[model samples]
Target: MSILFTRLRHTLLPRRNTVARPSDRIQVALLLLLLLLSLAAAAGAILLGAGIHVVESARSVEQTASRYATTAVLLADGPSPGTVGRSGTAGEPGPARATWVTRNGRRHTGDVDAPAGTVAGNEVPVWLDATGAPAERPLTPLAAAVDATAIAAGGWAAVGFLLWLAYRCAVFVLDRFRLARWK
Candidate 1:
């Protein structure tokens, strides 16, 4: 620990024997500024995570209030027809026709996604909105938190990488100037 501290101290406050070059001072200042910005980015990550959680929570609350789960019997096969999301890629779950009773005690039949290889007459649980329409499952709090964390981590990593690239470019320019002076 002491060895690490010594290295850090030296790196942050190197001993100077003579007047420092203007370029050297500028480089140091810019590095310090980048460090400060990195700290701010860390804080921003937390705020972003909190924002994600809040949005997901509100959506879950709305879904739970407006939707209810009901048991449904498969009319044909498992899985639904067409793509399930924006990507237009079908998941392992296939499309099938299922029948269930709504909250108002009305019988309804619709197409829903079911486990692969599911046959007709198989009973399955499905979510329905207040209007007796089929609805997707709501995101859970845990899932929201995980997604937020991943996104924040990716953001921080990107910032760090950009800073490193900028530092390398600065070093290259400073080296070129020093070489020109020597020549």
Candidate 2:
């Protein structure tokens, strides 16, 4: 089959006569495969990252639509200093009993984040979901883009490393085969 291919190739394009060994053919095939894998890895990483960014951006928009920011009046003193809250950080704000008025003029009382050792009647900023419950702020567009870019770069680097390892292994094996044949 290789002889036929060589004859066809020589006839199609005139070039200096040179025999292509089976090992050389195999090596050339592997090189082409490696190039294809590298390209695929790059494209896949970029596509996945773009998908993540789109999903995150849409989620941010949905959350922003149903969430709002408001101020709440503390009904009781916050946790004493040096006490960690849910976030496990003593310096971070702790949940405290607080009351706030909603846009519909309805009164609500719930737990809200306030600085440690906060006195009663102090006002603190908070975000409320559609149900008027304390909630987290929505993700911003800039944050989504940053997350996507980081994912894309990390994924590409990881795949590129693997591809490099494969290339190294292939070279080692092919070189050994060539050396053994020569010997």
lDDT of 1 by residue, 20-137 (tens): 6767767777788889988888899878878877887787777778888888889887754444533555556766788888988999888887876677888887888888877887
For model 1, the superposed segments whose C-alpha errors exceed 4 Å read 1-7, 18-21, 79-91
Off by over 4 Å in 2: 1-32, 172-183
All candidates' lDDT scores?
Answer: 0.79, 0.85
Candidate 2 per-residue C-alpha lDDT over 17-133 given as tens digits, one digit per residue, 9 for 90 to 100: 556666666666676788789899899999989999999899889988989999999999988778877778776788789999887888999899888888899998888998888
What is the Cα-based lDDT of residue 131 in candidate 1?
A: 81
Superposition-based RMSD of candidate 2 using all C-alpha atoms, in angstroms: 7.7
Give the lDDT of residue 171 in candidate 1: 81
Instruction: List TM-scores for all candidates, in order.
Output: 0.81, 0.72
